[model samples]
Structure formats: structure tokens, C-alpha cells
Target: MSLGGESWRWLLASSSIPAIAVVLLRIGVPESPRWLLSQGRVDQARAVVERLRGNVEAFEDLVRNHVSARRVRYRELFGKKYWRNTAFGTIFYNAQVVPYFAIYTFLPLVLLKMGVGEEDTTSDGLLNLFLLAGSLGGLWLVAKMSRRGLTIWSFVFLIATMAPMAIWPDAPTALLFPLFLVFTFTMSAAVNLDQVYPPELFPTDLRSSGVGLLNGLSRVGSAIGTFLLPLALDGIGFSPTMLILTLVLVGGLVVSLLWAPETKNSTMD
Candidate 1:
């Protein structure tokens, strides 16, 4: 059944909310002092930190404790550690985005094929509702667990949820929607930690480059996955194809657990 007209309006309203947030960020956010230092403007960085901290003594302490702690130089992010973190972060971020796009593209198509007519957009409505709920839950998870913990648990949740979606395609809608909820919950929330986690793993000087490169590279993987999912869905069908999603989540879970160091209380100098 195709969604009734109200369903389209609901999706429009739902997506519009996030768009508003993005616009607010663009207008309201300020640049970081670390970026200034990373660009070789040490005086500008000192000025920014001094203004932020309200005392030169405290700022100097930060420079000594955090900024100058690294002897390899922040510029050495072009070296091995940066490359390793960037590569891992990029690959993992990409893995995270794949299932999201897969759902965006495949879910409606699947619903359409499964006998949802043009007049009913129940699947779309259900998806939008779950997405909102997942987002709210993710915010709570972040508030309660810290970003790193949520990042870890997001992958774990993804792995656990993928099992049901893979094995029980024939299940009733009530059960199936909850499985979608699990997957959507993690996928949506993972983006918050993606940028947060990588920079924490890198030194303060190289943080921006590390985060930028990783985020950029992950999108490449997402693009590839987006292109490939339809082909996989066409050839392998739902259950077998979705198992690939399960495996991807499993890989992400393993990779994240192994490589992502905890950064809950850490901060840049």
C-alpha cells in the first residue's frame, strides 16, 4: 500500500526538523583555537585560548600540559599514527553510514513490493516515527553514557539488531518495526560519535585533519555502499542480502572495540 498523502507531509515535517538544526549550527557555531594552532598561527591560538580561559597562567599551563606534551610535533599527523587512525576511522565511519543509506533506499522499495499500495504510506510513517524515537533515545544515551560509551554500544546494538532483521523477514509488522527501530537507533546516533571519537584519538594539533580526513573517507565508503546495495538486494533477495548488513555491523563492532580508546573526560589543551 502506498502511503496516504498525510504520510508524505509527516516525512517532510520530520526531515525538516533536522534541517533546521543544521542551519542553526551553521549560523551559531564558532571556530576552535586548536585549528588556529594547527595552521601554524601560534600567536592566534594563544590569543584565542587566553580569551577563552580568562588568564594567561592557566592558558600557559594548558600549552605545557596538553599542547607541548607531544615531541613528534602536531605536524607529524602526516606520519604513521595519523594515517592509522585516519584509515581506521574512515573505514569505520563508512561502515556505519552504509546501513542507513541501505534503509533509506531499500525500505520503501521493499514496502512497495510487499503489497503496500499507492494509497498507504504506513511503512514510511512507521520509519519516520522510529527514526524520531531512535534519535531521542540516542540523545538520552549520550546524556547518560557519554559519547564514547554510546559509540561502543551503538555498534553492539547494531550487531544485535541485525540478527533479527536478517533471520526473520517473514515476521509480522509489529516485530519487524522494532527491529528497524534498533537498526535506525544506532545508525542515526553513530554520526554524533564519529567526529568526536577520531579527534580524541589523535593529538590536539592534528585533530582537525584527522577528523576531516576520516569523515571524508567514510562518505566514500557510504557512497559505494549506497550504489551497491540495490544490486545486492536484486540478486540475493532480503534475508541473504541483509546478512551482509549484519556482517558489516559485526566488523564495525569488532573494529571499534579494538581500536577506539576511551575519551570520556579528555579535552584538548
Candidate 2:
């Protein structure tokens, strides 16, 4: 049954429950020990560490010997030493998220073009479940595979899956559905690396600022792509739109091969 009328209002309003829960839960969260140490609250930092783990001696020694009090400026991300990381992060993140948000935002339209109507909630729900499974699989892959390998392979698989839809937009729903399931799975799996890479790319000093800037830029890219997607779909139709999105994935693959660093099992410094 298609939901109509004020059902959207309830759906929209229900989002606030999670928002309120997050706010409440955040109240009990402890401050980051590194940030605390950076602020020179040695005792408080040690206390926080002690609360979390039994052995605080190693943490204490590392803080005393290695860390220094310093504030990182956002402009430093563009400097020669860090510029490559910043560039890679910005491009890779935008590349994935742009098509990701665009497709999910207009999924119903895309599905309709592929012979699956909007009212086929069974397919939609299945796609969502595949996304969740892919996410869990991605977390496991992080432990089993190197960061660079996982990133590069995920992009490769994403392109492979999406290429079919681009080439055969009028393929029967039977074929299209399976292709879409693979695309959604690979896309969500690759997205897990978004959380893995940025912090590793920068040192502790610049971690927060670098991640913040990359995340902000990604939002802008996603918003622009989301805004333009419907126009592209309406103007050029499904096959061409899928072709364009596939190109975006190709760009990500190229950049990942060139710039994605191997941070797995590497020092944060």
C-alpha cells in the first residue's frame, strides 16, 4: 500500500526520536583523552583513560613523550606535505557520495526506468537489507584486507556492476534487479572506508580539521549532484544518466589507484 497524505508528516517527525536520543547519549560521553591531553589536563586525561582501560601507564608515557600542545589551522591542509592527502580525500569522498546521494534520492525514478515501479516496496526493502549486509561485510573486510586493497577493489566492483545498467538500460527487471543489488552492496561497502581514511591521512594534530574540511566539501558535492540528477534524468533519460554516474565511479577508481595510501597496520604519526 502506497502511503499518502499526512503519512509523510509522521515519517518526517519520527526522525526526531533518533536526534533526541543522540543528544541525550552524548551527554554521558567522555571527552577525547587526546583532546584533553592537548589541553594540558593531564590528571583529567589520565582519569578518562583509566576509566576506559585498566592500563593507563602506556597512554601516560605516550602523551608525556610524544604529544605536544598545538592548534592546527585549516589552511595547513593545503600545504605541500599534506596537500596530496587532502586532495585524495576530497576527490574520493565526493566521487562516491555524489552518485550515492543522487541515486538513492531518485531511486524510485531510476527503478521505474528499469521496470520496477515505485510501489514495489519489496525490491526497495531488499535493497536496504543488502545495504546493511554489505556494511557489515565491509567492516569484516577492513580487518581481513589492506585498506588500499579494499578501497581499490571496491571501486572496481562498483564500476563492473554499474556498467551493465548503463549499457543495457532497457534490460528486463529480472536482470536489472540483481545488478542493482550488486551495485548497492559494493557502494555501501566502499563507503565504509570514508570513516577509515581521513583520520589516518593526517596526524593527530590536524586530524579533526582535515576530516572536517573533507566532510564539508563532500556535502557540497553531494548537494550539487543531488540537485542536478533529476534534471539529467528528465532531460537525457535513464541510460545516459547511468552513463554519467558510471563515469563518476571511473574517476574515483583512477584517483584511488593513484592516491589512496596504505594506512592499514601503519602508525598514525
Candidate 3:
């Protein structure tokens, strides 16, 4: 933990240890029954499914119909029928990350700009914990809420929260924290929708492709936003940066309004 010159390496390695634990935990887990069935190992699939569900015979038709044996083709993602889904997923993902990542990656600096002392170390950790709690709360709410409604409202709230910072750049230092929490909480909910909606938008063959494309686009957006934010902060100043990010959220709202399909209560084909 106290590697002197290698302290930076320790910081980089912090998450790897937990990842190793996950790999170890997953090693003993059985292969998915649906996967086995798709592979033509009907007996093994039946055994696994029956062991888990106690009624494989009853669910056999459903599994056979639902799980496909065909490999996922990258080309299919760009095909006419699937292209909209691809674009929607990519844009939906980009919509959230561009602003959210900018805010997240620069929050400490933003706080400092708001007159919070540089030595205030506890705020970041506390804020992250609160954000994580909000994410979990959003996870719980997902089952009850429609994806389109949830996503639209989340973007609306994102715009609402950022509006204050954009309008009153020199706002009272006390107001920053609460406004930031609201923004983070709403953004987290939208992120949850980002994770949920993309896969559902595609069918079995294209689902992974859709989700992967969304995540890749999201990472790119995050990288670009993160890289640009400091320059924006220094060049145009904080209020303009806030307005830009608010516009990014507005883009998400527009996309959700125009393109996001309601998958709620509808069967995934």
C-alpha cells in the first residue's frame, strides 16, 4: 500500500485486485443452459436448466425459440432493419457520457473554482458514495418505470440542474453541492437507462453488438469530453462550459423524444 516511488502504480493496480476476485468467483460457475442448448447439447442443457428451474420441459419451447444458434454478424448491425437501433444506441450512449463524464472528471476542479479549498479531500469520496447510492436507487426504480419516460425525465432533470450553474456562474458556494448531487443522481439514472435500453433495442443476434457499440461510443465521447473540458474551462470559462454541457443533455432529450422506442412490457423479439 505504501510503495514510495511506485505509489502511482498502486493507484493503477487498485481495481485489478478486485477484478481478479471476480474472475476467481466466476471460474466455478456453470455455462448458461441456453448457451448449451444453442450449441446442440440438448441433454446437458436440459440437465442444467432442470437443475436450476426444476421444470425444463415446460420451458423447453421458450428456450428453443428464444436462444439462437447463429453467430452475431457485425454487418447485421449496419443493415437496414438494425441500423436505427445501432444509431439510437450509439447516440443515446454518447448523449449521457459527453456531459456526465465532463462533469465527473472535472468535479473536483469545479468545486475548487466554487471556492472550496484545495485541501478538502473528503468531498469527492462522499459525493461518489452518494452517487453510487443514487445509482442503486435508480436501479430499483427501473422495474417500475418506463424506459422512455425515465430517460426523458432524467435528461430534463440534467438540464434543470445544469441551468443554475450556467445562469449564475458565480452562484453562492453553498448551492453548488446540492445542485451537483441532483445532477449526478439524474445522470446516474440516465446512465442506467443507457445500459438497459440498448440491448433491449436489438434482437438476440444483434443485442451484444448493439450494447458493445453503445459502450464503445460512450467511451469515445467520455474521452473527448474529458480532454476538452479543461480547455473549455480555461478558455471560455465555467459558465459557458456549463451551457455547452447543458446543450449536450438537451441533445439527449431530443433524441429520446424523437427516437427512443418504448420497450416496456413488450417482449424482446
Candidate 4:
């Protein structure tokens, strides 16, 4: 599904619009001295800070502080504190992706099946509107919320929202669309927050590995979740059907709340 021939040309042309990226860097771009020292380039980092800050004294102090943060023992990832964090992260992180993608990606079709269509009141416009609201709502939530905090809040919304769709299958349209609206909104927040949480929790040594393993495992769960939806929910009722899935979220949240530490303000080194 990659770009082929003319598609490649078209894509490069589309991607070449980088004037703003250059402008933004000129306006303000702070280099990480930690990045320099990690690569064994201390002198280069010092030069960068001196040039950027215009005062060698203050800049050197800041670089020293950055270097202190960089002194992480990679072995700590295998320690007790980090071990369960990695395991729980891999399990639930993978678990959430399953149901989330199944529902969110095919939501329009799901809505149509539930009765939003060309002949329906909004004539498919409702789904488009829901997506727009969802995109904006996520942007707003992420700006002010911790990844874990946002994840917990989203789970509350999902339990409240999805339960009704399953419980009251014949629920009125008036009741349903709001659930749809909120479902899309919260799903965006949940998915993004889940993706952001893991790497920050790990030290630099295993950070990428931890996130990559979690993400790779979650992609498998997503495939299975999609497979189950058609085979199960489509045939059975959506209410009792999601009981197991709901429990999975509850389990993930419980683990995260009790054991998943806050990482929003923590520096990753």
C-alpha cells in the first residue's frame, strides 16, 4: 500500500511544504545537553548551551543539572520497581488496543447499523461531526491532563457510555447519539494517553524496548478484538456481550491506579 510511481511523486510534493518547520526552529529550539552527554559529546553540549544562553556561567550550571539527570543506571529497569511496571504495561497496554480500535475505526459503520444513515436525520453528517468534535476534545484533554489521569477519566466515560448501548439495545436515538459523541471523544483521549504512558515510565535503557514490545503485543490484541467483534457481538447482543470486555478495562484501570505510578512530571533518563 505504499506510494507507487506517480503516487511517490505526488507524496513528495505534498511533504515538501516545510517552511513553517524551519521558521519554528529559528524562533525557538532548545537543545538537550543530556542528548549530547549520552552520546559522549560533552564539549559539543557545552558549546551549544554557551551559544544559546549567551552566558557561560548560567548555561554551564544548567548543563550540569541536565547531566546529573542523565546519570541513569540502565540496570534499574530489571529491579523490582520497574519489573511489574513493564509487565502490567505490556499486558493492559496491549489489551486496550483490541476493543478501542475495533469500535473507533468502524464507528461510522457501527452507527449506520444502529441507524445513522443517508436517510437518517443528519444524513451521515452526524458521524462527521462526531469525528470533528472527538479530534478537538482529545486535543483539549491531553493539553492539561496527565496520561494516567486522562486514562482513568476515559475509562469512567467508557463504562458509563458503552454499558447503555449493550444494556438497552432498543434505547432511543435521543439517548444513543450522545453516547456516540462521548464515546468518540473519550476513545481519542484513551488511545492517545495509553500510547504516551509507557516510554516515559521506563529508564532510557529499556524505554524504547518497553514501548515497542507493548505496542507490538497490543497490535495483536487489536486484530483479535476485531475478529471477535464480527464473530461475537454481531451475532449476540451487545450488552452482556461486552461484560468481559468491560471487565478487562476495569482490570487494567485497577492495576494502573493501584500500581501504575505517575510519570507526567518525571524526567526520563
Give me the candidate number with maximum lDDT.
2
Predicted candidate 3 versus true structure: per-residue lDDT over 134-200, tens digit per residue: 7897897788899888888888988998888888978887897678878877777667777678878
State the displacement of the C-alpha of residue 41, model 2, in Å, after optimal TM-score superposition: 1.6
lDDT of 3 at 255: 85
Off by over 4 Å in 4: 1-36, 43-79, 118-123
Candidate 2 C-alpha lDDT tens digits along 210-263:
999999999999999899999999999889888998999899889989999899
Best by TM-score: 2
Q: Lowest-scoring 10 consecutive residues by lDDT in candidate 2?
A: 60-69
TM-score of each: 0.75, 0.94, 0.87, 0.71
Q: Candidate 4 lDDT, tens digit per residue, 178-212?
A: 78677766665566666568877776656766777
lDDT of each: 0.69, 0.88, 0.80, 0.68
Clashes of each: 10, 0, 0, 1
**Model 2 per-residue lDDT at 140:** 89
* Candidate 4 root-mean-square deviation in Å: 6.0
Residue 184 lDDT, candidate 4, scale 0-100:
65
**Positional deviation of 2 in candidate 4, in angstroms?**
25
Candidate 2 wrong stretches, greater than 4 Å: none
Off by over 4 Å in 3: 1-6, 30-32, 54-58, 63-72
